[model samples]
Target: MSFSTQVKNELCRAAMHRPCCIRAEAYGALLHATIFSHREIRLNTENAEIARRLQLLLRRAFSVDCAPRQAGSKIQLVLEHAEQLGHIFDALGYDLKNHVTYHINRNVLEEDCCIAAFLRGVFLMAGTVAGPDKKSHLELKTARHSLAGEETSLLLDLHLSPKMTRRGSTYVLYFKDGASIEDFLTSIGAPRAAMELMEAKVEKTLRNTINRQVNCETANMVKAADASARQVAAIQRVLRTHGEAFFPERLRETVRLRLAYPTDSLAELAARFDPPISKPGLSHRLKKITELSAAEEE
Candidate 1:
């Protein structure tokens, strides 16, 4: 399957059992989280599109009115019914455990790259200004901005760690800014999303690995078949060119029948020839043809 299809399939499985779930919203959050968690650099156009899509999803899924605030850099969702929205998402399987996982193993580094972009967008859109902290990594600055108009600053630090694999690469994300990761997760209802998303990622990776193995096997079979066809053709060409004029009428017929069905064993070929040629005799004919072909090539 294509990479997009694979990601969709993983999403489908993760979204299973929560038909009433806010699929688009949750997926948007995941996508946003993914982009925001990793990359340090991105184009403005790309960031805008992600923000637009995410805003649409959140609005559609949660019925929560949200607009791009902070000079079109952050999204401001006025959640007077925060508890109600939380309950709905919780019912729909939104949790921190669901979001933290390596969803697809194929092109892992690339996948992480996408996730980082997503997280960056999410943070910016969620009214959190992201910039380099003292350490020069991404840090979420949620202070009462002139645009936010007296909202308290909420500080959170998100970080991604590169992991080496036997054949490729992978990544993991953490909220380095939180005193307790669990507390932060519980507050945001991320565990359910985290757990489901992580499971989907693992399952998707396994499927990809299996597909690669299957493709390799099929390619090997095709190669073997082609080689066998060439070998049989070579034998026939040698026999026709070098030995046809010397063979007796009956011997010629017997040899032709054997070569016509090259896969037949010597015993099967002998049965078709009058007086029943022995296995050794059949072997001699084939060996002689091979020798002729080799000598001609040399």
Candidate 2:
């Protein structure tokens, strides 16, 4: 299953011990649902689990029954009766007839647990998280601008910094930082999903570190091989122009070592000296040989 779906499914199993928390969660779900107004209360979802959870939440919170009906690939829970809709609005402390502006009932979410439950319900209805393998992102979308603003404030109250943007007619509240997303997931009762995200992040960092190390090593090997090949060619030219017998003892010894260990690194060749020399000393001798060969060619 997708990461978003996995998180939602886990959240579905979250326990609501208090009646207040249950009502808060249900209120969040209804507010963000496809249609939540006085005339009609409807929820449409492709996830059967969300549909089921909403049905149970409504019944538990307000004793309202909403049987989900399958519509093609989607499931919908609808309550059209005026009495049932009025009861839902009343239970949520929303006065549809008298209130000019719609706002979240902060009283129900006074406790931290209730706030978490409410956010969880919002996510189940209209939230999505990108797979950690791709990017770090978690977003909740709603058509109600006022609801989105209230959610941002609620998150801030919980010490979470969320960004808000408008997408067409919808307002989106999102968390971009990986740590923030993980914390949010954990707070909403998806600890397993949060752990998975962290694991994926660690695995990606490790893989990148290994690749950089391999590239550095490979580059060093190529540089060494190129230097060695040039050194060999220069030594061969010196020998051809001035026979080995004409060279001094030190130069002759260096020439012999180079001819014998064409593939050995400078350190390895240096170690083979009668009295081992440092890598820099060996390199200086090799440079002198190259200068002599160049002079002979000129």
Candidate 3:
């Protein structure tokens, strides 16, 4: 299943114990419903859990019944009669005389529990979170700009912030950073989803770090190989241009060891001595030989 679907299914497992929270959650679902107004309430979804949750919420929150009709994978609930719509509109503090404005009523979400529950309901209907294998993204989509802005304010009250943007006719509120997405998922009772997001981030970071280290080591090996090749060429030139007797007596042994192990690094060459010489000593001898080769050319 998709990450968003997994999260919603997990959230559906939350117990409906608190009456205020239940009503507030149902209230959030209504505001984001396909159509919720003075005349009718229409909810459409392919998720059987969501359809079932809304049915339960409508019944428990307002003592209203909304029958679900199934066609293929989609289930739709439509309530149009005045008697059924009146209970919902009145309980949510909406007047039957006015059309729905789609703005959140802050008074209904006064408690912290209710606020979390309400946001959870909102996500069940309109929210989506990308899988950890891809990118970190979470967004809530709504048709009303005012509702989006008002929801931002509500989130701010809980110390959570989201950016608002217009996508065609839809207004979207989203979180791009992982931390914010984690906070959002946890608040909506999906801690497992948040932990999965964190794990994905950690894995990506570790993989990148290992790649950089391997590249650094490979580059160092190439650099060392190039330097060794130049040293061997210089030593060969010095020997070809001048006889072994031309060397200083103290340096002849160093030259012999170097010629014997052309591929050895300075440390390995130094260690080959009967009484090991220092790496700097070996490097100095090699440098003198290269200088002498250049002098012979001049």
* TM-score of each model, in listed order: 0.31, 0.84, 0.83
Clashing pairs in 3: none
lDDT of each: 0.40, 0.88, 0.87
Worst 10 residues of 1 by lDDT: 147-156
Model 3 residue 180 CA deviation (Å) reads 1.1
RMSD of each: 15.7, 3.6, 3.4
Worst-scoring 10-residue span by lDDT in model 2: 93-102
Top model number, TM-score: 2
Candidate 1 Cα misplacement greater than 4 A, ranges: 1-187, 242-292, 296-298
Model 3 misplaced stretches (Cα beyond 4 Å):
243-298
Tens digit of per-residue lDDT, candidate 2, span 1-298: 9989989999999886899889989988888877777888889999999999999999999989999999999999999998898888888877868632458889878899889889999999999999878789999998889999999999987889999999999899999999999999999899999999999999999999999999999899889888878878877876776788656677888888988898888899999998999999999998887777677768
Over 1-298, each residue of candidate 3 has an lDDT whose tens digit, in order, gives: 9999999988888789998999998988888888888887888888888889889999999999888889677898889999989988888888888887777878888898888899999999999999999788999999998899988987887789999989999999999999999988898789998999999999999999999999998898788778777766776777886778767888888878877887787889899998999999888887787677667668
Better-scoring candidate (lDDT), 2 or 3:
2
Clashes per candidate (backbone, < 3 Å) = 35, 0, 0
**lDDT of candidate 1 over 58-105, digit per residue (tens):** 555555454544435543332334453454344344443344232321
